[model samples]
Target: MIVAAVDAQNLVDALGLGSIYALMAVGIGLVFGVLRLINFAYGQLIMAGAFTLAYASRANWSTWESIVACFAVVIGLSLVMDLAVFRPLRTQSPATMLVATFAVSFLLQSIALLTVLKVQGQLGMPASTVARLSQAVTIWGVDVRKVTIVSIVAALVALGALALLLGKTTVGLQMRAAATDFTTARLLGISANRVIGFAVLLSGLIAAVVAVLLTARTPYVQSDFALHDMIYVLVGVVVGGIDRLWTATLGGFAIGFASGVIYGALPTDKTAYLPSVLFALVIVVLLVRPAGLFAPRGTSTVERV
Candidate 1:
């Protein structure tokens, strides 16, 4: 019975983590689809949202108000980034854009660190209002946090809504065309700026949602709140096939679920090595499926727009 209970708990936790990672993957993959640039600064968007929630909580704001602030901050910063950094660098080499994102990531982290130190004189802030979701309810003799269910449902709903946007909307068609061949799409009268802006908007919205869900699990907001998870999700996206969004999402969920299970299974003392073990497995998976584990067998490395 003890072992069975532990297994059940692990499964639930894995699914919860997987759902969060899947959302993160979608945010990354969406922008990648249109921009062809991997934004290393993506995590900072989540961090920004989390900080918004933290500040709101400190001010005793209503839940809805806090959520609104989070979305507003994340989305606003996303557009600023698109305009200030990405737009000018759009014509540059991929390496240049990639390095720029790295610089942006560090800059954002430094800003957050400095701002928090100056204002709060601390390295972290508690988003206590959103922490209520961490409370657990019993289900079939197992306890499950509300955030777990919310994460899973949110992912499904977001994905479904995105599908409709992409499949049924005209702008979605233009975005698809741009992703496939930007030069051709531009020649066909598609506005590159519009398509990229919409993609960044959608990505920022998803990041805000991820911020809420993650804060429920770990209510303390820090400069590096989502940084490590972003790294893992990036690896998972590549392992699952970054060229395609669906595969990249699956890759994110796969890694998150695997990490949860591995952590649960390892002895308490050995849990510190989880990253080493997990990454080692990732290396093996890449060796076996260089094109991506979920990608079609014959899929080429060529950009799949």
Candidate 2:
């Protein structure tokens, strides 16, 4: 019974992590859908929001106020990235734009590290206020953290709302068209700037939400807080099928869930090999389904919002 209970707890925890990764995948995939450029700096946006939350907590701000600040910082940074980097490089080759994102990512990390060092004389900050959510509640004789439940609910609601927006709203249709073919969409009078801006805005909003949820799970604020998760999520995106948003999201969740399960099953001393084992499995999956594990057979890599 004890072993069964432990397994159930692991499943719940894995579900929560998967939900968070799904949101991240959506954020990354949204920008890719519109720009045809992978924003490698996407994790930096989450880091920024996390730091903002840490700062707010340091200032003794209320939880709601800290959340608002996170949204503001993340969304503002997203727009600035669009205006400063993406807009200017709009006509550049894909390789160039990709390199630009890497540069931006490193730049943001350096900034965070340096700023924190100067202000706090350290590299990490404790978000004690948000960490309270990590407290577990007993359900069905198993303990589940409040943040786990919140993460699952948030992902469901956000994904549902996004579906409605894309299926039933004008701007969402415009985004879909742009994703399908930006050149043709513009020819049809859809505003390229507006569509791209909206994608960035929505991506940033998702990032902010992820920041809050992730910080609740791991309350330490650091420059590389979400860096590794972003890499894993990118892998999931590619593995699940980057061509479609839903497939990409599934990929993210699959990886996160697999990771959680693997971590739980491994002996404590042998856990260091988790990434190697996980990625080796990823290689096998890609070899078997190069188009994407969830992508339909014969499906082309055409972008879908």
Q: Which number leads on lDDT?
A: 2
Regions of model 2 farther than 4 Å from truth: 1-6, 301-305
* Model 1, span 3-40: residue lDDT tens: 44358888899899999999999999989988888899
lDDT of 2 by residue, 21-104 (tens): 999999998999889888999999999999999999999999999999999999999999999999999988888899999999
Estimated TM-score for each candidate:
0.96, 0.96
Candidate 2 minimal-lDDT segment of 10 residues: 1-10
Question: Residue 125 in candidate 1 has what lDDT?
Answer: 88
Q: In candidate 1, which residue ranges exceed 4 Å CA deviation?
A: 1-6, 302-305
- lDDT value for candidate 2? 0.92
Which run of 10 residues does model 1 get worst, by summed lDDT?
Answer: 1-10
